[model samples]
Target: QVALRCGANDFGGTLMEENISRAAGAQYGVSLSVEEIRGIIREIGRIPKERNTLYEILE
Candidate 1:
């Protein structure tokens, strides 16, 4: 949230699994919906974009 407001534009991957994070006991979960992510991005006054593995926009 703060990051977006501070001019961060990248939001990383949407469908990728967080297996390494989970294995390390990060409790934020592994998956998030595109809608949910977009909502957060909008809440922070940034546009949400869906991208493919090669960083091409899908939405």
Candidate 2:
């Protein structure tokens, strides 16, 4: 929430099995579900956007 209020806007979805952070041993687990991400963003009064591979908005 602090990050969002401070103008940070790049939020990501679930990481795939071949994700880099997982390969690099990032132990972040099960905390970033889609609903959780949307809830977090909503707490700061910002709408969450779903984007495509080319960074185009999908929803």
Candidate 3:
């Protein structure tokens, strides 16, 4: 959340096997489910959208 206040805008989705962090031995989980991400964004009063590779909003 502090990162959001510091101007981090994009939160990546849960549609992939994000094992690179675990491969690097990080303690956190690899990814968040899409609904979880959306909830977090809404908790901070922000809108969440599903965007395409070209950054077009899909939802």
Winner by lDDT: 2
RMSD of each: 2.9, 3.3, 2.7
Q: For candidate 2, write residues 1-59 as lDDT tens digits.
A: 99789997765444344354565688754446778888999988899998876889986
Runs in model 1 lying further than 4 Å from the true structure: 6-14, 20-24, 27-31
Candidate 2 Cα RMSD after full superposition onto the native fold (Å): 3.3
Model 2 residue 36 lDDT score: 89
Q: TM per model?
A: 0.59, 0.63, 0.65
Estimate, for each residue in 1-59, the C-alpha lDDT of model 3 and write its tens digit.
66666887764433455665766798875666778877877888888788777878995
Off by over 4 Å in 2: 12-30
lDDT score of residue 1 within candidate 3 = 62
Predictions in order: lDDT: 0.70, 0.72, 0.70
- Candidate 2 clash pair list: none
Q: Could you give candidate 1's per-residue lDDT for residues 5-35 as a string of tens digits? A: 7877765533555565566698866666768
Best of the two (1, 3) by TM-score: 3
